[model samples]
Target: MPSIAYILSAIGIAAGITFILRLIPFGIKSILKDNKLIADLAAWIPMGAILILGVYVMAEIDYSSTTTALPYLIAAVVTVLVHSWRKNIALSLLIGTATCVVLANWVF
Candidate 1:
């Protein structure tokens, strides 16, 4: 049986290997700048990945509880609407976080 230290070391090695594998595309991209499509994709991939991750996080909210995530959903929607109207990201985030906190603590 592997000890905790061994398990941790294995995980570290695996993570390093994964990071190196992921870096291959970046290195290749630097060398392949002549290809317009590949260059565009390489540039957009990171931003697209972040957008997808954000959407996934928002979409994966648990709606059944009607307690924690529901408030967050409400707050997020309000925040987005407010930000759209006011163009204030900081205010929107603050409002959303405050709304969530308040709703979460509110007695039903």
Candidate 2:
């Protein structure tokens, strides 16, 4: 177990970092507001984040066994198809997660 002094210092460091991060938006709020480049970056960031998450998830799959991999593959397909059809990220993610959960719980 860590000493109280060590724990308190760690917490203080975390708090300080959080305060600095929170202050950054205030410092740049005016520059961020109504900036087309920032707006464009904000729009693309979420989709990019989703794709990166998908890649990481896909990389974790055990490809040697078809049974274990089937649900993940199916979920990926469902996510892509739903996204293409609806063009809604949240809905597609929800449906894909539901599909994966159902398949893992009941089908597999």
Candidate 3:
């Protein structure tokens, strides 16, 4: 085991780091509040997230054959169409999920 002095020194260092880390959020809170950059991030991040999800999902699809691609393709097309018509994220996601599940399990 380590010496008591060594353990105390380590604990002191850890406590100092933790105190600084916890102090930082409050330190920057005023600067971040009502910032235009932060407002833009809140508005655009959702679409960016959705686009990243779409690209990641598309990248995983096996496009080598029709049997593998049809379910995903039909689901994507249905999702896009539903989103276009209704502009409802939850409904589009639900319908797309249902379509993929049914097609993947029952038909394909």
Candidate 4:
């Protein structure tokens, strides 16, 4: 029942909104880059997130069963060691996840 022009107008409105939304971050990025407090917060936030995630994961482990917790402990250790030694996040995460998966499936 809708006219062709109505459908085209709706599509054009959606496309325009999407384009503007995509441009907003780039528009604000230059302003944020010059802000020292924002820069510090941005730098600290990822480390904070990692710490929170680590605490959450550790808290979920069952201490009563060594087998249940061993893989996670091992993986965490491996991840920390790799990251410390190589300073490569992607490599550390990949190795850590693989270690956990292998240990859980085969050793644990």
Candidate 5:
């Protein structure tokens, strides 16, 4: 059997490593804040992710079936319109998601 000191030491080591790993990102964030590349990445990454996701979603739609594609098309249109009009990301996303859900469940 392992001694109590050995187990305690193992636990302490694990906890210290966990804490340090979690802290490293925060420490680096300040250093990266002024970096032009990181700043550009921060601005573009979400847009890239959204674009990728939109492409993936569109690819899943059945082009032959109007019924299958209609809800997604409508929801995407509403999302863009809402975002353009209100300039609120959360509201646009909520409205878009709700539109998709309602149309998919009831209309489509």
Candidate 6:
């Protein structure tokens, strides 16, 4: 088991590094206000960040056991299909989770 002090120290270090990195872009924007290229690139940063996170989540899935993943896979697929059909994220998520629970027990 990990110690609380080590966990807190790691968390603090991570937060501090992230905060400093975030400030770099803002500082650059101020210094290069007249550069349209820099501004245009910065505009796509959010989309790039989202794409990176999405890929990370997808890539991190454990495929070694179907038992744990099947439910989540079913839920995600149901969520997408329901959202596509009904155009309601909240309803889709709720129904997806219910379907996943039912399917999990039914299949596995």
| Candidate 3 C-alpha lDDT tens digits along 1-108 | 999999999999999999999999999989899899989999999889988998899889999978888899999999999999999988998999899889988999
Identify the leading candidate in terms of lDDT.
2
For each candidate, the alpha-carbon lDDT, in order, equals 0.81, 0.94, 0.93, 0.93, 0.92, 0.80
Rank order by lDDT, top first?
2, 4, 3, 5, 1, 6
- Model 4 / residue 2 / CA error / Å: 3.0
Question: Candidate 1: which stretches are off by over 4 Å?
Answer: 1-53
- Pairs clashing within candidate 1: none
Question: What clash pairs does model 6 have?
Answer: none
Model with the higher lDDT, candidate 4 or 5: 4
Q: Candidate 2, which ten residues in sequence have the lowest lDDT sum?
A: 63-72
- lDDT (Cα, tens digit) per residue for candidate 5, span 1-108: 999999999999999999999999999998888899998999899879888988899889987988888999999999999999999878998999899999988998
lDDT of 4 at 1: 100
lDDT of 3 at 20: 100
Q: What does candidate 1's lDDT look like per residue over 19-72, in tens digits?
A: 999999889876787988887998899668856865896888787787757887
Name the TM-score of candidate 4: 0.87
Alpha-carbon shift of residue 43 in model 5 (angstroms): 1.2
Error of 6 at 92 (Å): 0.3
**TM-score of decoy 3:** 0.69
The better-scoring model by TM-score among 2 and 3 is: 2
lDDT of 4 at 23: 99
Summing lDDT over every window of 10 consecutive residues in candidate 3, give the lowest-scoring window: 64-73
Model 6: per-residue Cα lDDT over 1-108, one tens digit each: 899999999999999999999999888777899888888988898668755854685577677888867776877788779989998756876898798788778877
Model 5 worst lDDT window (10 residues)? 46-55
